[model samples]
Target: MGRWGPDARGRLEAAALELYTERGYEQTTVAEIAGRAGLTERTFFRHFADKREVLFGGSTRLQDLVVGAVERAPDTPAPLEAVVRGLEEAGAFFQQNVGRLRRRQAVIDANAELQARELSKFAALASALRGALLRRGVADPAAGLTAEAGIVVFKTAFERWLGETGQRDWSSLLRESLDDLKAVVAGDEAQADPP
Candidate 1:
């Protein structure tokens, strides 16, 4: 993140997403992406293995960042709070990079293959998040439920972030989505309870 290179990984990621949207993911080659970004193809390959990788480029690193956040959070944090805290930690990666993400999301929303890959990546992140929670000694059902809930918050926050034309914060939106999720859960529970 800190000055990876003259044509660092982030620039490549941005260039690839823009090209993927304009040219279509299937048609955009690594060479073309690198060239568009004024970088060598080797630089592109170094950052991303293939075109699809560009769409999901930050996921692995984001997963790690979120896990680190989980580990760093207060020991007695609630399950939902823990999830939001983890997401907040990871949100830094997207704070100034929403444009690239919106482009990638646009491409993914339009392409079934990309959408499927996005689904798979999300599942993988959920699994990783669940593991992180358990590693911190978070109990069963709560850990699994919180992980899924965290994913919902991330998707919702991301979409809300995309809705805006002007710059805004990701963490605030992320937190609000989780809060809304809690409200929904509370309402559902109330409906289920007898009068």
Candidate 2:
């Protein structure tokens, strides 16, 4: 109870993911998760507001990382580049917990409620990124567009990283996805040009 208190939250998170994967999200309960973690329901509540919170808890930290990154980014950097830097910072969380990320994604993919929550999280992140960009001196429409596009890049890279077990890292996948987006946009521009 003394030293383990520091690690209880992590244990509860791991136990929750395992239970959610094994029993399905809706079927799993906080009591069961606490039991699996060898902690009490009170301890679980102390760590997470509820069961859904376990999967979405890190979102606040992720958002903070992104916003801080954008604020710290050089003013001369392109809006998209700034967005990428912010997202890359946030993506570090996924890199550190790939297994939990994969299992969490699978659980979310299997449930409509969880899927809705995931989308809401993404939307909120995009909005936050947009605001961050605007604070960085980027104009309207452009800031919004860049932020939304960043979400797409982040999501695509995240899914690709989770789907495979290769040695490729999250930052690499994010850069590759951003590059792919640039290529696609450039191709569209070339096609629109009068040749």
Candidate 3:
């Protein structure tokens, strides 16, 4: 790829991931990433604020997707149901990017700072979901509670999905995780048995 490639951001992200995987994230530098991508340091800065941003650049886009799903959800569903709708949308997104996400998760798992940032990202997503639910006429505690619960479901489902061998789809895993949550909340005896 040329320095002025059409997918400068994609190239930068790929390059950064490659370097971060090959050499530790802390050991990689912006100039090396730019060189690997056939981009200049200036081009890298234009696409991302710093090396850390490479991992987090898509967070805003993901947040927007979830919030938009929640906003467009039908009014008949309960707050948690509406939150599930948003999570399902996010599941679709994750399904399409499983490979990249797995690699990103590996990178994050290897670094304490990245793990902290990942938690912050989830917190931000929860806050965004709460705001969307509130805008959809949900009450304060319900909106907050539902949003937090949805994030928990999402995180649990996502971890399970990552650990699986791709036999199941993202939506199914999400629904199953949600079902498990509901079972636990309702004190279902069946949940006591190992699955």
Candidate 4:
């Protein structure tokens, strides 16, 4: 590849993930990742601040997607429903990139720092969602609660989706997780099954 190659960022991410999987995250260096991608360390830095950013570079985009979905949703739905609508949009995004997400999750699962960063990303997403809710005229505690609950639904569904070997999709898992949350909230004993 040329020095100023197209898709340098993508090539760097794929190379980083491959190296992280083979040599472990801490063991992989930015130089090695760039070399694997046939690019320079400067090129990697231009695309990402550090090696960790390879796994996290899409966070801002994801937050925008979820928040934008909530902002664009019709105002008629309840706060939680509006949040779910946002999550559904995110689900579509994840569904289209399930393979990369699964690989990313595996990398995160293997490292403490990456796990903390993952949690931090979720917190940011919740905060953004809360802001979106507030802008929609939802009250303080309700907005906060709905945003947190939406994150829980998303996390649970995503974990299940990652663990599954079947053909189930992200949106279906999100809906199932949301239903389970509702059942537990309503104290519907028969409806809430143990997972």
Candidate 5:
């Protein structure tokens, strides 16, 4: 049993990604990750509850951070706008960690189990955003739709963010997604209105 150093958690995550890349996720074990990081199995567990969680590490913290930003924003912005802005505010965190984030995403993308877990994480985050929207007095379909739209926007923005290096910020990508969604929805509305 060894102590989990201050960098132990991040080190484990990095090692897990490397191992996942070199040997695939199914072939990589906690002991191997621990050994790679010069940590003990006990220390690995201390940092990540399980293997699947290594890819999902810090997501819960990130979700809370974004939601907190939404709650703190002035009540003037529309529900969707508030959530998008909250997500945008989280750009600082993304910028700070994009390299590791992208590497983790690559590992997850290469594994079906990890992708399923990633989808579940996205669903949970969307649900949390919906709850936050409802708390702001948005009603019914609006809240659900706004939250869903925010998730779509976030996803699109994330894809673009990962496509580029640090040259583009998350907020710009988010705004572009929001605008694209608005255009798509507006066009659909026009077509449905019997123009």
Candidate 6:
């Protein structure tokens, strides 16, 4: 065995995504990922627990980024604004990784298990966001709803970004999605039945 290099993890991730896309997630193996990356299987284990982790591994870091942002947000911002601030912070995770994300989404969408994991990750993030809001003095229901709303906005923005061809900032997409959510909510008041 040779000394592990700094790029081993990144190489493994790239190789894993490539293999997962080319061979189908279920067909890809850890050894294949390691071989494609020019690393050993041991190196792959050092970076990820299994093939699936290669796709969903970043969830923890992303959740931390968003939660930290929410905790640090100023008191002046409204609950939704604070949540958006958190999402904007988390958006940085996908800033220049749009293509990679698109590939990942495709792989996840093609697999039922991966799709379930994706949803679980989103649920975990929403729960974390709710906890962060609660820590910031937001009461129940409001904190929970605000957190869920932020996740909705983030997911919608991410989908829109994934479909785009021209290069665009991820944060900008998030902001636009947030605006769209606001508009939809505001327009809901007009649905009242005639008296």
Top-scoring candidate (lDDT): 3
Q: Please report the TM-score between candidate 6 and the true structure.
A: 0.89
Query: Who is ahead in lDDT, 2 or 3?
Result: 3
lDDT of 5 by residue, 1-195 (tens): 235458988888888988988888899899999999888899888778898898887788889988888778888998989999899877888888888788888888888888888889989988888888888888979988888889899999998999996687788899999999999988853456555
**Which ranges of candidate 4 are over 4 A from the true structure?**
1-3, 190-195
Ranking by lDDT: 3, 4, 6, 2, 5, 1
Error of 4 at 32 (Å): 0.6
Clashes of each: 0, 0, 0, 0, 0, 0
RMSD to native for every prediction?
4.3, 3.7, 2.3, 2.4, 3.6, 3.3
- TM-score of each model, paired residue for residue: 0.83, 0.88, 0.92, 0.92, 0.90, 0.89
Please write out the lDDT profile of model 1 over residues 61-115, one tens digit for every residue. Answer: 8888887888778889887788788888866677667677777778889889988
Whichever of 4 and 5 has more lDDT, that candidate is 4
CA shift at 8, candidate 3, in angstroms? Answer: 0.9
Q: Evaluate residue 82 in candidate 1 and report its C-alpha lDDT on the 0 to 100 scale.
A: 86
* Model 2 lDDT per residue over 50-77, tens place: 8998998778788888888998998888
> What residue pairs clash in candidate 6, if any at all?
none
Task: Give a tens-digit lDDT track for model 4, residues 1-195.
Answer: 686878888899889988988889999999999999999999999999899889997788888988999999999999998988888877666777778888888889999999999999999999999999999999999999999999999899889998887588777888899999998889884745768
Q: Which one is best on TM-score?
A: 3
| Tens-digit per-residue lDDT, 1-195, candidate 6 | 342878787788899999888989999999999999998898789889889988877788899888999999999898989998888875656866878888989999999999999999999999999999999999999999999999999999889988988577777888999988988888853556878
Evaluate residue 195 in candidate 3 and report its C-alpha lDDT on the 0 to 100 scale: 60
How do all the candidates rank in terms of TM-score, highest first? 3, 4, 5, 6, 2, 1
Better of 3 and 4 by TM-score: 3
Candidate 3 weakest ten by summed lDDT: 186-195
Candidate 1 error regions (>4 Å): 1-8, 38-43, 166-168, 188-195
Tens digits of lDDT, candidate 3, 1-195: 676778999999999999998998999999999999988999999889899989997788889988999999989999988888787787767877888888888999999999999899999999999999999999899999999999999999889999888898878888999999998889883635666
Worst 10 residues of 2 by lDDT: 186-195
State how far residue 12 of model 1 sits from its true place (Å).
2.8
